[model samples]
Target: MAAATHAAAGRVSGASTSELGAAPRPAPPAIQRVRRRRRPSGEAPPLPRHLATSGKLWLALSGVVLAVWAVVFVTDSIAYVDVADTRILQAVAEVRSDPLTQVAEVAGGLATSGAIHVIWLVNLVVLVLVRRWRHLFVWLVTGLVVVNLTAVAAAMLQRPRPFEVEIIGRWSGFSMPSLPVTVLATFLVSTLYALVPAGRPREIGKWVVCALLAATAASRLYLAQDHPTDVVTSVVLGVAVPLAAFRLLTPNEVYPVRYRRGRPAHLDVTGARGAAIVRALQDQLGVVATKVAPFALSGSGGSTPLRITVRAHPSAAAEESCVFGKLYAATHVHSDRWYKLGRTLLYGRLEDEKPYHSVRRLVQYEDYVLRVLWDAGLPVPHPMGIVEITPEREYLLVAEFVQDAVEIGDAEIDDAIIDQGLSVVRRLWEIGMAHRDIKPANLLVRDGTLFLIDPAFAEVRPSPWRQAVDLANMMLVLALRTDAARVYARARKQFSDEEIAEAFAATRGLTMPSQLRRMIRAQGRDLHGEFLALLPYQLPPVPIQRWTLRRVGLSLITVAGLALAVAVGVDLVGSPL
Candidate 1:
């Protein structure tokens, strides 16, 4: 019995040991599962790889291009090529000698008249309405800046006109870079920049436009308005300035996205927080803002002088910050107080705090117009930020201001001013843009320089009706401010009576006094005035000719068929009889 009990105890103990060994051990302290990280799908694209990797290469290439152009320019300046001169003189001699040439010249002259300018101006108005203000502003500002710069340069250079040159019409001033050539070249470049983007179409369009511009420049040389070197230099500067400006000002990213179904898309700002945006802009533009005593202006919103000044920094450059701010404020604000404040501050008050509604609307329109101009790489204020002052009351736009500037009206409109103004208007018309509000107030004269401003009411598409209105408005403004007859005479020298009439018609609403209309009518009755009237009325004859020929051909064919039918009927009736 004792042996059996001991065996049973051993068996039970062995079974208990086996059961302990079979039980699962607690899992080795689990290692946390590692997860792969990923970036958000909507993250902004990083800086372009080419720009990042080959920055020095790009700089080197730019330098090379400039160097090549400079070498070519210097070579041309030292040695005069008379190819254009000889060809032109020959053509002019032919015109004088041959009756056909004279007839052709008259026809061409009639064809040109003021029709082209009117058409171009009308087109510009349409573009402006379509929100292409940037393009218009850029073209106008560029032309103005170029003309002023060229005038100053011409004055400085004071190069004499070609000796033994045939006296054709009237010629004056020192001609190195021909004003017409420069104007034409610059105008073409600005227009191309405005119309074409960097793409296949742009590439093709640029080539065609450039060819046309070259032909135009050559024609100026043929007309003896400029030397070859002058034309070449003008072309070089024309191409260079806008290209550099475009590179500097135009952002790589698409902006002012087309409104979807007429609804404005929210601006895609890199920094949404206001304080951060301000700081970032300040850092980027080298602006120093010092608080000045708050002062109330006569208009609406109270004005506080921020005393915002710009200084050139090691990293950042000083540009027109105040002007940029003003533009921004004008564009972003919906409140009457801010709009009134901006306009009042810029133009100042005429009556005791009364808002100039026309001026106010003009300012707002200019805000939109300036955007198109800035984008097109024309000379204007560099925009920084739009400041909304209180959610409902006021807003301040920050821009770079033109320092040490004077108004064009501060002094008499000299021949130089008239020439510069005409050149500017011509270029704007060429690009299908019009500075509808062309007045002395809008013309900023800084250091004998003319800068066109207040393009809010401007248009950017082809419309003779609108252009005529713009012209009439400008004429009226000039008449009211300065010597009406002198202004009219100067205008008549460049624009025909028809163009003036069309402009008057387009802006007929601008006539504050019926007396102005009567004055225009009386002037239009004169022989010279009648010639002017004929200018804008001469629309392209090609379309009308084509339509007329088509109709005549169709009528002749119908008459011939009717005759044949009658003969056949007569023959059949005789046979039956």
Candidate 2:
């Protein structure tokens, strides 16, 4: 009864007692696994410790290498080491002259041969093995061949070598594009790619290899087998070929970065327009804004002077930027192109007389003439900006406006103006320059100081006849406004009447229409008579004929009109009687 009760209790409580018989707990149902949280896509894998350590080591090595190279460069400069062509020439001479030097020559030749062939073979083999890399292989091969050919062609041109020829051995090839130099360069580059690990240390290793290759190439020239230029060409071809090949093969390897060193990185603004320009400039350069201002005021081309204002950014603190402005004279719908006109009223006759087409080109031509005059040191306004009008109008030139200068048309011609004008003519002769358009508007007077202006028709050439004509034109223009005696007296003080005659004689050859001459003679009768009386000779016969014709024609017309008036008056009197 006691045993039966114990068994029953154990069964009911589900407790494990050292029982003879017990139902085994059913094995826990195969664990229903909980799902794990998914990681975000494109997450970076953790860097391996080995790679990180390697990179740090490489950076340290590169630092050390750069430091060493710097030291060597400085020391070499200070010590005056003749490691260039001169040293190499000396070594080559010693080797060639001495019988025992044959060993060294053979050794060098063997080394060069080995380096050149070995690298090429390796690259070719690797390219072949990489079956799907035909494009890369083709680019590499093509680049190498092109560079080699270029070097060879340049070498054959045979530019003189930097060093004196100390031919201890017979040298046959041209002194440029050294073949051995090319070989060494190509070999080192190709080998570096194959062997050097990719990191900072690898970069340093590459530089080291390059330096060694360069040194070896230079050695050949120093030995007198090649010229310095030849060796340089070889090195260039070697490096350029492989790098070009690599770029072609791995297009993604190209990393371009714009470097701005001493240039201003700020946008300069002077006004609203300038602000917009500054913003655009900033966007382009990826820099900040420094200052702003309204652009300088300049003149434009047209019959009416148009003023243009513009904003600009200086390239540097010391540099200036060139800006071109445009001005329209009228809203005329004559042509498809815009035309500009000069604002100064001085251009009124020109506008009325000349064909009104393609004025901007003409203005540009005038600007060019001004530049020529400026370069010749003539007293013309310093041109700063140019204004382009439309195709039908003239342009306005923005020049340094002579603030105090008086226009010759507005000023009285005193001895000072006369003397200054003569002096200008003399200077023009000295510089072999001629100002074709010598009018009153082209002359300026400042505080009794005279300056030649409007050199748009000036020419720079060695022609005394042309210069004489230029002087004659000036004298004629002056005579039109001033008393001829006064002008001649002033001009004669500096120039002989014979010289003046010679100038006038030269002027006669210039194309002046008979009609125009007649008109001018009628206008200048008083002026001409006074001038001729002062001179050693009478006025020219052609001018006298034109003057007489004009006078006779006027007298005949007057007589005819008077006769008609008398007849009409007599008839009226008879009717009254």
Could you say which candidate leads in TM-score? 1
Model 2 misses residue 538 by how many Å?
A: 6.6
Q: Which stretches of candidate 1 lie over 4 Å from their true place?
A: 1-45, 48-124, 165-172, 256-577
| lDDT value for model 2 | 0.46
Task: Name the lDDT value of residue 208 in candidate 1.
Answer: 80
TM-score of each: 0.32, 0.32
> Please, what are the lDDT tens digits per residue for candidate 2 over residues 10-115?
4533422112121111111111112232224563211101223433454455355445435745575512322465565665565554544554454345225455
How many steric clashes does model 1 contain?
Answer: 52
* Residue-by-residue lDDT tens digits, candidate 1, 1-577: 6576456435533332112211111111111112322324663212211232233444455466456546755676533435554455566545553554344334323113143344335535654666654455555555556667777767766666654556342346776655555555555565555655544666787788677665565445444555656666666665666554444333222223232333111222232223332443344333443222121111112122232433333343443223223312222332334444434444343122233343244344456666665554343454444443222222334544555555554555554455445444544554567665565555554544455554544677745544554455555544433554666666655554545545544443232223444444555533224323444443322111123353455457757966874554333222210
Backbone clash tally (model 2): 30
How far residue 186's Cα lies from its native spot in candidate 1, in Å, is 2.2
Looking at model 1, which ten-residue stretch has the lowest summed lDDT? Answer: 22-31
Candidate 2: list runs displaced more than 4 Å: 1-361, 387-396, 462-465, 479-482, 506-525, 538-577
